[model samples]
Each structure stands twice: as C-alpha cells, then as structure tokens.
Target: MIMCREATKLMSLKLDRPLTRREQLQLRLHTLMCSACRRCESQFELLHGLGDKLPDTDDTSSRS
Candidate 1:
C-alpha cells in the first residue's frame, strides 16, 4: 500500500507529467482506501486547472 506522503508526491507530479501504469495503479489504490488523500487529489486537480486558465503575468520585458 502507498503511504500518504508518496501518494501526495505522485498527485503533484501528475500535474506536471503523466504517471506510468504502475504509478497510476498505486495512486488509485491508495486513494480508494484513504478519503483524505482522495480529497487532496481532488484539490490538487482543481488548483492545477485554475492555474492553466490564468494568464501569465511575468512579463519582465515590459518593465524598463
């Protein structure tokens, strides 16, 4: 069984890249048994989606 720490790490990495089949399976299993991790995963997805829709504001070139 995957620990909450490792599961959380996988959840964050999922935002940046795709997980392997084994990784996906492990995370799925952990979330299935752990409600807290399940909720954390949902929050991570929501935050990541919000980030994608926001416009980039780091325009240093616009400054003098």
Candidate 2:
C-alpha cells in the first residue's frame, strides 16, 4: 500500500498527465484504503479545474 504522502504526490502529478502504470496502481491501492487522502485528492482536482478557468492577468491591458 502506498503511503499518504506518496499518494498525494502521485495525485498531484496526475493533474498534469496520466500516471504511469505503477503510479496508477499505487494510487488506486492507496485510495481504496485511505479515505482522507482520497478526499484530499478530490479537492486538489477541484481546485485545479477552477484554476484552469481563471483568465490570465497578463492578457489584460490597464489603459483607461
């Protein structure tokens, strides 16, 4: 079983790209047994999605 820290790390990486075979298996195993970590992972995904929707400030001009 993967530890909480390891699982969280892998979950973060998954935000950018699909996890490797080993990482996928580890995360599955870890989440199956750890509810807290799973919740944390879910929250991370939600926050990541919200961030994606935010507009970039650099694209906006301040002239008025």
Candidate 3:
C-alpha cells in the first residue's frame, strides 16, 4: 500500500501531468482506504478545476 507521503506526492503530480497506470492505481487504492486522503483528493480536484477557469495573468504583451 502507498503511504500518505507518497500518496500526497502523487496527488500533486497528478495536477501537473498524467499519472502512469500503476501510479493511478496506487493513488486510487490509497484514497479508497484513507478517508483523509479521499477528502484531500476531492479538494485537489476542486482547486484544479477552479484554477482552470481563472484568467491568465500574463500581461507583459498588454503592457507594451
């Protein structure tokens, strides 16, 4: 079973890139058995979704 530390790392990495099948399975299993991690995973997804809807902050071109 993946520990909380590794599980959390995987969770963060998931936001940045696609996880491998093994990593996805491990995180899924960990979240299933750990309620705290499950909640965290939900929160991470929520934040990621919200971030996607936010406007980009790159205004350097506009400044000129």
- What are the RMSD figures for all models against the true structure? 1.6, 2.5, 2.3
Query: Candidate 3, after superposition: displacement of residue 8 in Å?
Result: 1.0
lDDT-wise, the better of 1 and 2 is 1
Q: Candidate 3 regions off by >4 Å? A: 59-64
Predicted model with the maximum TM-score: 1
Question: Best candidate per lDDT, number?
Answer: 1
The per-model lDDT (C-alpha) reads 0.97, 0.92, 0.95
Error of 3 at 7 (Å): 0.7
Assess every candidate by TM-score. 0.89, 0.86, 0.83
Off by over 4 Å in 1: 59-64
- Model 2, span 1-64: residue lDDT tens: 7789999999999999999999999999999999999899989999999999998786357655
Q: Tens digits of per-residue lDDT for model 1 on 1-64?
A: 9899999999999999999999999999999999999999999999999999998897997899
**Where is the poorest 10-residue window by lDDT in model 2?**
55-64
Ranking of models by lDDT: 1, 3, 2
> How far does residue 49 in candidate 2 sit from its true spot (Å)?
0.4
